[model samples]
Target chain A: MTLTPKGEARREALLDAVLRVLERDGASGVTHRSVAAEAGVPVASATYYFATLDDLFVSALRRATQQQVALFADLGEHDLRGFAEVMHDWAFTHRGAAIAQYELMFLAMRRDALRADAEAWYGALEHAIDPERLHPVRTRVTAHAIDGLLLRMLWLGEPSTVGEIEAAVREITSAISA
Target chain B: MTLTPKGEARREALLDAVLRVLERDGASGVTHRSVAAEAGVPVASATYYFATLDDLFVSALRRATQQQVALFADLGEHDLRGFAEVMHDWAFTHRGAAIAQYELMFLAMRRDALRADAEAWYGALEHAIDPERLHPVRTRVTAHAIDGLLLRMLWLGEPSTVGEIEAAVREITSAISA
Candidate 1:
């Protein structure tokens, strides 16, 4: 159903609150009541927009995916160093969003309904790597490699330095170019 | 604490039950009651052996890690083709174990106590790459790449063929060798 302007605004507010709750409390912290409180709305507002917690999670993940896509859209224009710098900066500044995304990915492993969102997120990574001038298979492998590295950094609570990021980016680019 | 042989056997049984529960029900499915039931032990036995659910989960993860390290110990003896073949077979036959491992990794992302297990798991992967004849940094990157690829395969419910695994492995070896 098409929402009115006010309805759309409220929906966005709720989605924003989902991220807030995720960042603050991790996945377990994201209850309807908590999200509603975070959004400064009645709990009914969350229930009114989202039929269940799964729906709310998917909405938030979709929003986060969109933001990531936007962030990576111009990656092709930049060199490997630039790409690495951007990613390194993002890892430091957006740890919460990154953690939430990984959590959602793990959640999707068990829930079939969330599979499409996970696939779309992977597809976005593929899209971002399209301009890297690599063979298709190489591009896919490299994308996953970068993904794994980033995941390790996040899980280990080790932020990637610019030098390390650049080295990884260079390795991928060189490997693919060859 | 030291225990009788029977006690050690029961503890192992409990840990095995944790993996079974994790595979069948996911992380949320794991509880003292559920694990005890799975193990065909009294609920009190579970609590007697493990003080809390977190303790049980960590013990299971540690056991899983030891098993993985054992599996990969001889990986350096094989060529990439052999390594890929073994991994592909494991992915198909031991899918539950793989899923549980990823689940535990995600859990470790939120809980600090599980981080060492995750690190040990990663370390095992790094050791397995010694046969690739690459620099230490290259080995580390390739390990993470293989991990990322395996995780994607598990998440997408698409088991990798030996051919696909070999190709990816060959790419990493060749990239680093060059």
Candidate 2:
């Protein structure tokens, strides 16, 4: 159902709170009451908005993915440095959102409802790598390496600086372009 | 701590129980009592075996990784089909252990104490890809792509069958070898 302007703001606030909770406590820590409290909305309002923990999580992940996809979409075709900066920002600067996205991936493994969102995340990576869809096989493999690199940055904290990350990106692209 | 044969058996049982509980309930569902119940051991035995939840999780993942590492180490150099079979079995047939290992990776993101186990996992993948450490850069990038492909298989359930998986593997390796 469509909501009033104020209701929309509250809904957005609740979704934001879900990411924060997910970042701080992982998936199991989120609940309607906790998220409502985190969002500064009434407990009733959270349930009214999301209705369940899964709703809060799935909605938040979708929103995060949209923002990230937009970031990738805006990049120039050969912007390795630009890509690295965005990766740094997402994996290090906005780390909570990155963790939230990956957590959603793990959650998606069990719940088929979240599969499309997970696929959308992977699709965005592929699109960013080859917006023109040229070299589909090469693009697919490069995207996979980039995806794994992103996870390594989060889990292992390697290529911690933008320069190093740019180098890592260059390596993958050059290897595929060979 | 040293243990009698029966105690060693009980400890292994508790670790096995942790994987089952992790697969069934995700990470947060694992507690001393819950794992003990899942393992058919008393709560005291669970706690005695693993004093805390982190201990339980880390130990189980380490064990699973060891088993997986051995499997990878046994692969012949040109055995892409064998690699595909192993991937299928790990992600599907013994699905719980796979999930349990991934869940530990998520946990390692938060806890530095678990970082070594997580690193060992990536190390195993790289070792599997190139046991002699030749073509370091190529191996690293290929491992990243392979890692990403594995995650996609688990999350999106694509390349579901062994033949499909082997074909996907071929695509990745051929793209890199080009």
Candidate 3:
């Protein structure tokens, strides 16, 4: 059923709550009650909006991925240094969201329904890198390399300096160019 | 306290059980009771072996990282292609352990005590890649890139082909050599 504007806003709020919970407590902390508590809504509201806990997670994941894709879509406008700075800031400042994204990725490994979203997220990264500048395989490889670096930074709880990230971006770009 | 031979064996068994539970269930599934059950030991045994759940997780993560470092330390013996093949196979066959490692990494992000282990894990990887051949920064960058690539493969639940991994490894090696 189509939600009224108010209902739509509430739904969005609930989804945001799911992400907050995921980031704060990881996947296991995300239950119907926990999400509802995080959202400041009644537990019934979560069940009403998303029939299953999986549905809530999937919906939140889709929204988060879309926002990220949109953010990356604009990266081409920035030079390598500028792009690296943006990435460095984005990851460190948005640590919670970044960690939550990885949590969803692990969840995708076990749940078939979440696989497409994960692929699309990676596809967005590949596209943002502007694969046209490189060989097809190199483009894919570069994207994966960047992915791994960000993940490592997150996992280690160590944010790379802008200079370090710039050097990495330049290295990958140069490799693809070569 | 130094343990007798049997006590050491029991401790090892408990740690293995932690990994098993971590692999089968995500980090959240790991609890005192669950680990004890996995070890086929009494609940008291788990509590006796590790004073707290956090202690158990920390000990298990250390063991896992050491084992990984040992595995990577031998990579020099293999040619690039051989190394790539092994990586491809490892990611696919040990998918559970791979994911569990990532899960632990996220846990490390939250828990202060676990951060050093995570840092050392990356340090071992950087050492394995051998920075002497590359500029110190380049070596660090290269290590992070490979990490990103491996993590992407695991996150997407798509095993890279041997050719794909080999190409990526060669590119990184060549870039460092240059």
Candidate 4:
């Protein structure tokens, strides 16, 4: 996937703006025109960057999932304190995308055009945890728990504060630590 | 609310079809025509019975909410047996309604007209938990967890089994058991 420098820069800016639109108004607020306005570019730029709504959505979801996977990967060896804080802070760092991602998931599940996207998104999620050698059952439940916590927190749009993050993580760890 | 026999019967039939449509098609599939068709009534009857689209959505949501509340209420006194069963038995039941409920929730959050509807739903959920008397700090977290668990298990679709439910409840009980 090679592109001109200008094209690469434009694509990055467009992706960032899509994230912004997703943040402020959720998935409903995102559109070709809106993303263009958000990126300070012509509407055609979005079409140039991505072929269809599904293309854009799937790419964005992949990017978000990669970020999430990287975030988890970098946290060495689960000290509880460090890992928990980061996990707790996630709802704060990317609240809009979290909400939009979940909303898109609903679309994926309900419509034929998007089920593959949803499946791929979930596959990325399970892959992020790497099921090898873990208690398959407990690991599956734990992943669901983690996914549920993030999505639910997004659904609630709970404002994050330092105190709130600490408290939330502590409560979460309390359940999962066993 | 008292009504003529025809009105009462129509209302009950409408609500039943509402749940059916929601379970089969997620939030987007709901429409007066669909409900009327599903219930074997004419679309004109739906229009006559429901003054507006918003009214219909609210009524359907209310019925769905009430049904869920009743289900939980029947569990009585916070014992986790049936809750566990529902969470675990996703294979047989399919998590259609769970996913549909979340979709409707997202839809409500996206628009002002619906947000009010959504808030009432959340308020009922809050009341359902009875966040008084034991561990106030943990109550909200517990509520969020429960919300997350339901959606997550729904997304997981079927791999989550009855034993998983039993184990999860045991874990939860251990954490919160004073």
Candidate 5:
């Protein structure tokens, strides 16, 4: 549904609040009441924006994924350091959001509706790596490796520093290029 | 805890039931009573085996990981086809348990207790790739890519067939070797 500018801002606030509630209490704790309370808005406001708990949860996930896609798209084509910093920020600095994003994929496995959102993440990574789409096969294979690296960073918390992450990125690109 | 052979079998059954519940109902659906009912065991048996929901959940995760590690270890070093088949089965045929394994990583992000279980998955992959522990950095970089590929399979359902998965595995290995 179309929303006014003020209405849009309120919707975004509610979405952001969903992530906070997810981070703080896990998925089970989320409800219209909890999200409204988290957003400091009326319960009616949350219910008006999100008809159900799944709507609230799914919208927040979409927002997180979109933010990540934007981050990847904004990177310079050959900016290993910039990529590393973004990776660090996503995995460590803004960790809850990253987890929420991955949680979307897990949910997508069950809900066919979210499959496109899940694929969008991989598409963003592939575009960031090869903007011209020069070599589809090579780019995809490389994207898979990088995807695995991101999961590693999130799960194991290794390549903990930006410097280390940069080094890992270098290894991936150089290995693929060679 | 030590168990008689029959007792051990019952405990394993309950753990398996947890995955079924998680697969069917998501994490929120899990409770000692639910798992016990799933296992067709008395509620007291589940409580006796696992004192709390967290205990039941974590132990099921640990069991799933152990099974996966054993699968990896059993493959012949050069058995790429076997690896592909195993991966396909894990990601598709036995999809729920695979999701449960990944869910463990999500939980690991918050609970320190599950970090080792999460790390153990990566370690298993690394060991499968480089059994002699040669080429530490190369093996790890390769592992990251392969890990990403597995996640892709789960989320996007790509490499949907064993042949495609085998081809993807070949691409990863040959690219790294080149």
Candidate 6:
């Protein structure tokens, strides 16, 4: 569907609002009313953007994927050195994204459309990481390893010491060491 | 609640049913009525066995914990080595369970009581793998890394190869080997 510039901007705002809703309140927060409220538009405007719940879900998921990809993209054209700092940021802020993503994952398991969105998200993630420089074997190994670490920290949120943080950095560096 | 042998056996059957429900239908499947249907018992039997939803959640989680522990108990109690085969089993047969556990983790995020239950589950997991072996730096690092690997595999399904699997196994073995 073609959109006027204003409509495009509003759509971006709506997608951002949906991400915030999903990030904050999770799956329960994604109703049409809530999206309208979050995006500063009337409830009717939500329909203008997303024709159905499936459309809304797919749009929100696309926004989440783009946001996550930008997160890694912001790390710039650097080597895998960017991983540790990104993880540290996740330990601080993007914490809830892990849960939202996990829940989406289970949802994806049973739904082919959602699974396609998820796979697209993962593909974007894989692309942003630039896996060629590191050994493909080690790159994939450490990729899952780092993903797991981020997930566990998000789940438990155990208090971390300076030393513990440094050690986690060292361990990741060593695992996929260039 | 006190129980005759028949009642005790029925309760045991009910808990087994809760686990089966979780494995099949995930967290939403644990309601008193749904679980009763799965167990082939009267709905009243659920209220008889589990007084409250919280009690039911804890019992179901604890039962999951026990089965997992018992499954590993046969590994003869080493560090990372003991879990290798079990991890492989999960990497295959119970991929769905792994996905569900991660989804259950998201559900826990919304509830403090359930989060506490999650902490308890992690406590059992941590107990199985000796912290001392992870050394001063690697303790939490190792835990998080393993978690990331498992979830990534569950998400990707069969995309990973034996070489990549061995790379993960090698990293864990090397960590505790330290």
| C-alpha TM-scores of all predictions | 0.87, 0.94, 0.88, 0.66, 0.93, 0.74
Please tell me which predicted candidate would have the highest DockQ against the true structure: 2
| lDDT of predicted model 3 | 0.77
Report lDDT (Cα) of residue B1, candidate 5.
77
> Stretches of candidate 6 above 4 Å error?
A1-14, A36-54, A76-85, A112-132, A159-166, A175-178, B1-15, B28-32, B42-58, B77-85, B110-143, B159-168, B171-178
Summing lDDT over every window of 10 consecutive residues in candidate 2 chain A, give the lowest-scoring window.
A100-109
lDDT of 2 by residue, B41-141 (tens): 78998888788777887788788777778888888886889999999998888776687678777766777776777687789888878888889999999
Fraction of native contacts, model 4? 0.20
lDDT of 5 by residue, B1-178 (tens): 7899999899999999998998777776788999999999999999998988778878988888888889998988978999999999989998877886676567657777888987888889999988988888778878888888888888888889999999999998888878
DockQ each candidate and list the results: 0.50, 0.76, 0.47, 0.24, 0.73, 0.37
User: What proportion of the real contacts between chains A and B does each prediction keep?
Assistant: 0.46, 0.73, 0.46, 0.20, 0.73, 0.38
Model 1 chain A lDDT-worst window of ten: A169-178
Candidate 1 per-residue lDDT over residues B1-178, each given as its tens digit: 8999999999999999999998888777899999999999999999999999878878888888888877887675547887887678667677777777776776666677777877877787787777555567677667767877777777776546889778877876665446
Q: Where is model 4 chain A poorest over a 10-residue stretch in terms of lDDT?
A: A133-142
List residue ranges in candidate 1 displaced over 4 A.
Answer: A111-115, A132-134, A175-178, B111-113, B131-134
Candidate 3: tens digits of C-alpha lDDT, residues A66-173: 888777776764377767866787678878788888777776677777777877877878777764645565666667667767876676645478887787788766
TM-score of chain A of 2: 0.92
Score candidate 4 by lDDT.
0.63
Q: What is candidate 6's lDDT per residue for A1-178, written digit by digit as tens?
A: 8999999999888888877787788865688889889999999898888877657767767667666667776666534446556666666566667566556566566565565665665555555555444545445545555665566566566434334554565566474453
- Backbone clash total for model 2 is 0
lDDT for A95 in candidate 1 is 74
CA shift at A145, candidate 6, in angstroms? 2.6
- All-Cα superposition RMSD per candidate: 2.8, 1.8, 2.7, 5.7, 2.0, 4.5
